[model samples]
Structure formats: structure tokens, C-alpha cells
Target: MESESSSESSLEKSMENVLHLQNSDNPGLILVIAPLNGTNYLPWSRAMKIALCAKDKIGFVTGEIKKPSKNSPMFKKWRRVDSTFWESNGPLLYNIKREISLFTQGNMPLMVYFTKLKKLWDEVQCLRPFLVCTCGNCTCGASKAIADFDEDEKLIQFLMGLGDHYDHVRNQMLLIDPLPSASKAYSMALRVEKKKDV
Candidate 1:
């Protein structure tokens, strides 16, 4: 009985390290991934692997990680994904990891994914040294587990009356996405591009 309880405790601790429930005085860094929706997971998961393998200074925080899993009881304390992930995606969720299928290369998926993500995080990485950038190996870290830009989209759109935060920036954006061709994905702001005139 004691061994069984001990084993559970060990598992809980390991999960806690992989997915923090809240910010600590020194929470290291946050790697915010998108929600576990079909459209968001692939790119976000790729971003997660790169961040995890690339840096010890940062960690991941995702809405999907909070959902229930086989060992749901272990993460009973992780019910808060907002305070935990610096943004909320509703109640705790988990197990979606099993549901995730590795995204393969076609048109060089990595090539395409990086292009979009880098365009988004490039500036953020360099400008905010203390941000996700500079804190990780690529010398740019932080965007690892950012709230799904899509999820944030709804909140931002719904709260349009709350005075815009990203609109000025978003409005100026002409739909050009950034690529992570370097193979190393670091968390940074974004690298916007001027739209090519048709």
C-alpha cells in the first residue's frame, strides 16, 4: 500500500514539473501552447517539442494538458489553466496528448510552421530579453506555450469593447506569416511582413 501511494506521489510530481498549475515566484518561464483543437494542435505540438528539447530555462503550459487523462486524479490540483498558463481555457483538461498525431513534412511542414511562428515571435524574442527570448537556447524563448492565438482571438474579438491590445498591430498586418526555417524554435514576439501588392 505504501509503495503504491509513493508511486502515485512520484507520478504526480513528474506531471507537475511538466505542466505547472500556477506561477511561482520563480516559475522559470511559460511555454503556452494552443488549445487541443484539430486546427491548433499540430503546429503547437511541434512548437512544444522544439521548446522542451531546446531549453531548460523554460517550461510548457497548455489548455489541453489540463484536460482529464487516465491519471486525472494525479492532476487534481491543476484545475486552473488561466492563473496556471497566464491565460485561461476554462476548467482543467488532459490526456489529449494521446490524441495528438505527429505532423509530417509535406511542402516541408516544419518549414511552413516555422515560417508562420517565427514571423510572429521573432521580434518578441529579441525585444524582450527577459521575455521568452534570450532565456532559452536559441537565445529567444517565451512563445513556447502561448495561449492559442486562435483562442485569444475569440476573447479579443468578443471583448472588442475593452479597448484593443493587438488590433493596431493586427490591423497593420497584411496576412503574411513567419517561418521557423532554422529548425530551432525560440519564443519571441512576432516578425511581421508587408503584404505583397497583387
Candidate 2:
């Protein structure tokens, strides 16, 4: 009995780290939650970034380790995405350039990240996105940092709650795991594209 009660308490605490039900109010924004670190980060991120922009929806990216400074490598890349990733997707560069402000700028502690994420969601209430996608180990360290017990389940439950908060019909909140391969990311991107077409 004690073990089960402890488990419930742990789950609630974990949810608090990732989500605050009261703060959930984005009607149509497709929030792309993702981690900044990983092997296939570039290809996966680039693919989804292009796909989201191509679909004419703003990709509000979160879960970055640190906000890019003016002198950061990421900033430099953002400056020259056109020439750099042109072969892959030329127009996405333009789209990112146009919507660059939507992204968070700097590194933060996990707790602060969640706080700011909630605030950003509230601020962008008017955008109204078609889908909210999560990518590449986006449990926001729930499995490790937040709680060791049922962290994955807590993350999924939190996401599902967000879907409800955003009024998503079903399957609108996507989880793209790039560890399997970039193919999975591409497949997820295609789904987003097809959904946009409809």
C-alpha cells in the first residue's frame, strides 16, 4: 500500500515538472518539443523544421540546451541556412528567418525551462497551430532528472493532457524518436505534411 501511494505522489510531482494544467491554453500552435543533444539531431531537426514550415505553421521549438548567442554556432548556421542547407530545403531557411523570434534564446535550468515554456504557450495563444510535435528524446529528462519511476509514462500522460488543453482531436501530439533512424523522423514529417494537406 505504501509503495502504491508513493508511486502516485511521484507521478504527480513529475507532471508538475513538465506541465501545469492551468497554464495549458494554446489553441492551434504546433509545439515541437525536443532535446538539443543526440547523434541524429541535425537531420531530424532539419527535416521537421522544414516540414513544419512547408506546411505553413510556425514551429515553436523548445527543449534546447542553451539559447543561441549572436556568436554561437547555431546563430551562425541560422544566418546562413540558405547556402548551407539549400540542397535539403531552401525555403525553410526563409521561413525560420521570418519566424525566428518564436524560438527560445538561451540555456536554462529544467524547472525554469518548464516555467518559460508555459509562459510562451500562453503568449502565443493567438497563433492556432494545426499540430504539436515532439521530437528526439523530448521527455525533458523526465526519465532521469524528474523521476526514476514511470518517467516515460508521465511524459506521455503530460503530453496527452496538453493535447486536451490545446483541443487537439487525436494524434495531433506527435513523438518523433530519432534514435531508431532519421527515417522515422521523415515518416513523422510526412504525416504532418499530409495532415496539413487535408
Candidate 3:
């Protein structure tokens, strides 16, 4: 009986150690030394793993520590630490935006340049998607308006990245009453390129 009781006490102590939070451990605590910029993913991840291991929290990320029931005492703390490790959208979004802003159609063919820009734009759209109304009774044109605005923004960015050789085409495209979608703009530029080649 005494042996069984001692084993039970040891198990409880182990559980307590797993769930224990040091005074410095909090949601706001920065775990790794370097924040994860868009680059340096491997090194950042390695450092983060090391830091989490040091804190006895690596299981939160490695899936060794499954989430307990909502009523369990460890639930909130687990959630807080887990969220901090996974919440990386802000840096990713910033990197995408920066890439879009810096993009330019240097010596590359129009098709290649447009394809690259389109990929970056698609990433941005996926990360920060527009909200669409799903209710059958919706009357406000807000969703369509938002979509149009997003397309227009993409069209402008596409045109802005074109070389000076495309100045006339870009200006003509801008003069349209409603801006063309980015794909339509790309098609227009492509036609111009074919003519120039001829």
C-alpha cells in the first residue's frame, strides 16, 4: 500500500512539473532571441525549439502535450503559450507587402514579371482575405465594393511595377472609367509586347 501511494505521489509531482509556470513565463515573453523575419526560418525555428525546451514547453508545439479539457487548470496556460508560438501572420504579411512595394519589371519579359507579381498578390489576398456576406437576406453592396477595391489596388500595383517602356500603356489603362482587373491589364500589356517584338 505504501509503495502504491508513493508511486501515485510521484505521478502527481510529474504532472505538476509539466504544467508549472515560472514567474517569468507569460504570454508576452519573447521566447527566442531573434524574431522570425520572413528570412531565417530554419535558424529561428531551431532557436525557438531550444527556448521552448528550456521552458519545459516544447511539448505544446511538438504535440506531445495534448490540450486538456477547457475546465482543466492547464488549459489557459497551454493555449497562451501555444498561440504565441504559432501566431506569425503579422511578419509574413509585412514581408509580402514589402516585396510587392519593391517589385519592378526590370529586364524580365512582361509575362515573367506579371506572373511573379501575381503570386505575391495572391499570397496577400490569402493572408488578409476580404469578408464576404453569406446570409441570403443581405442587401448592402459592401462585399462587392470591397472586392472591387481590392482588385483596383492590385491593378495599380501591377501597373506601377512596369518598366518605363510601358508608360504609354499604363497611362492608357489608367484612363479607363473603371480600372481593369490585374489579369486584364496583363493581357493588354502582353499584346503590346507582341506588337513591339514584331
Give the best candidate by lDDT.
3
Model 3 Cα lDDT, one tens digit per residue, 25-50: 76688887887654555687789889
Tens-digit per-residue lDDT, 1-198, candidate 1: 999999989976776665443334233455545643433555765775575445421333332344446477644544443233343323222222212112222343333544543333332322222334445564442464342442343223222221233345444332324322222121111222122122
RMSD of candidate 2 to true structure, Å: 23.6
**Which runs of model 2 end up more than 4 angstroms from their true locations?**
21-25, 28-198
lDDT of each: 0.38, 0.38, 0.82
Displacement of residue 163 (Cα, Å) in model 1 is 43
- Which tens-of-lDDT digit does each residue in 1-198 have in candidate 2? 999999978965643332322233233333345532222345556666775455322222432222246975454433333222223223443443333234332454333433443433332332223233244565555434323232343234333333232334224434333122222323443465467669
Q: Residue 43 CA error for candidate 1 (Å)?
A: 7.3
By descending TM-score, how would the candidates be arranged?
3, 1, 2
TM-score for predicted model 3 compared with the true structure:
0.59
Clashing pairs in 3: none
Q: How many backbone clashes can be found in candidate 1?
A: 34
Query: What local lDDT does model 1 show for residue 111?
Result: 38
**Model 3 alpha-carbon drift over 4 Å, by segment:** 1-85, 134-137
TM-score, candidate number 2: 0.17
Worst 10 residues of 2 by lDDT: 177-186
Q: What does the lDDT read for residue 97 in candidate 1?
A: 20
- In terms of TM-score, which candidate is strongest? 3
- Error (Å) of candidate 2 at residue 53 is 19
Error of 3 at 86 (Å): 3.4
